[model samples]
Target: MTEQGPVELIHLADSENSVIVRVVGATSAGLPGDGCLIAEIVAASEFANGRLTEVYLLPDDLDDWAEALELLAAGRTVSWMDDGRNPEVRIELKGPYISQGQTLNAVEVEVRDASVSLTAVRVLVRLPDDWVDAHRRKLDQVHKAWPLGAR
Candidate 1:
């Protein structure tokens, strides 16, 4: 995570491909009453680039992400804003773990932009060193920094 910049909503990256879901404007600055954020979900590969900068990442989506880490660690698949379109961020464990505290494992990430010509790219990321904890901490920081107001 970049300490000097804002916390990323979701980030999956490697040398070849990079997919990110990031919020635009302030959380409170979104629609009134509901107050939702307009996020940008981007999928970039060495060959092509796809971006969905108008995706609506609701407050409930943030709540879902907090649970996603748990499901992923438990070998369950999860997706964020997977409305059969947009840049869907789906992640799942590659295989069963060999042992407990196995910080290193394989994860499959898929970034699909069905809204624009249906662009999908999947990558097997070598999730290193307690990825769940790392991501949880980042999520925690984001929640703390840009906490949404009460309904």
Candidate 2:
């Protein structure tokens, strides 16, 4: 919430099953001692035909979702940082139907400046089902129209 930059959603991989989402950001002045990054991972099987059974936040930087929620509930600022080395933060969700149809279905989100440059936000998701075809088609259409850096 510290004057966050733009949020970009990049699809890393999309198939029939499983999805990995990564949320990241770059820092220009480094991580603040009193700031932390809050990440929220929500997976719904109703839409993707899979239920969210597990969730993980990588880098072990700040606190987990529970801890973050606690702090936030107590009125605290959750700030994140990127020193250009670490992955910033990663969220992985697993479910029973994660690998039903295909074996390679993942979506990654990448956030960057809309104009100038610098900093980014990446989210990767893995979905299980035959939705890959539609996703691919959508991606193709988006690419054709935007070309690059259109997000």
Q: After best superposition, candidate 2 residue 25: deviation in angstroms?
A: 29
Tens digits of lDDT, candidate 1, 59-138 = 67778888898887677899866776446788877744444565456677787777657567777665564777777877
How far residue 42's Cα lies from its native spot in candidate 2, in Å, is 14
RMSD of each: 4.4, 16.1
For residues 25-55, what per-residue lDDT tens digits would candidate 2 score against the true structure? Answer: 3222354422222223323232443212112
Lowest summed lDDT window (length 10), candidate 1: 25-34
**Candidate 1 structure, TM-score to reference:** 0.73
